[model samples]
Target: MSMTSDIYKTIAKKSPESLFKDRGSKFIGQAHPVKEEAEIERILTELKNKHSKASHICYAWQLGKNYEHYRANDDGEPNNSAGLPIYGQLQSFEVTQILVTVIRYYGGTNLGVGGLIQAYKTAAQLALESANIKTKVITEALQIDFEYALLHTVMRIIKEEQISVTSQKMELSCSITLAIRKKDLNSIKKRFDAVFGLTVITENF
Candidate 1:
């Protein structure tokens, strides 16, 4: 997707756990759809508690509509063996606002770096493949202020354009907040601007 595009891909929900085994070691993988950085810690804490006996809990996450933010953690595994390979799956799938974690259970065998990479990558791939992927559009909030007399005109435009009214205050002077798709902002803004007595302001999310 283009840098300017407002469309993005993300998992719809938490994926069912996936398992991979190599050299007697077990790797458990899961994918989660997360919106904010704060959610990551809570998820990790829960996973750590659930699999307290696991050897390593490696993970990777990508956030933002442009996929501008990301993190990868190898836990106690060798360097890039675990985390980087898992992260590669996120890029390969072109998904953002998601996290993939791999839990390892030592089976009395040491799979060197190469084996670890393959194991983690395969586990993460399986988790994602079982997930429900979805496409989403980034949206911006817009505030419109106009006199009550112009309410009908505004409502007409809103209905015709299929704009979502997030909130509205009806009085002599009325105010409304609209959720607009980022891609359609310019054209929609221009249409509202043409209304003689209407004022439109973009609100920062």
Candidate 2:
């Protein structure tokens, strides 16, 4: 079956040095979920605030199939050189919901149109390397409740396995909500059955 949404993360960043010494560049890449519009604006604000003194701040963001729906400001650099290069890099990597901004502090010398393009591209490449990428997998939600004594055992297994517990309560009994893949159900069931010597309850996510 085709899932409506798939989670993804940045794995590695790519930035290479340029012989164009007259130009200096900086790259900042961050992963974001497309759940809300405010999230994008907030990140952009943070970038601007961080590099308030830079000569120019050029950026691009990908949110959905309509990628061209984004805007980039060359700030003051020659026309398309600054922002487009950064956007090109994102397209090459097939990334989305990511905003990359390149801050440039002009060296006394000027990098004409070609040089400016290389400089901005180089900056975005550097930021790309700093991110870690990951792919999300679908899993079911399982809830478990056990006495304090047995809670430790359950937690231990959870920590050691691929399952991730999303919530929990620890008063007389520890009630936990965990996320697990369907394929691993039998194995987890066996382990729990052996440890607690009983069955547990589960709920759909």
Which candidate wins on lDDT?
1
Worst 10 residues of 2 by lDDT: 11-20
Candidate 1 regions exceeding 4 Å error are: none
TM-score between candidate 1 and the true structure: 0.92
Root-mean-square deviation of every model: 1.6, 7.4
Best by TM-score: 1
Error of 1 at 87 (Å): 0.8
Give each model's whole-structure lDDT.
0.94, 0.63
- Residue lDDT tens for model 2, 32-117: 33434576678668767886876776776665432334556687788888888887877666665566667665556666799888
**What TM-score fits each model?**
0.92, 0.52
* Runs in model 2 lying further than 4 Å from the true structure: 1-36, 65-69, 137-205
Q: List the residue pairs that clash in candidate 1.
A: none
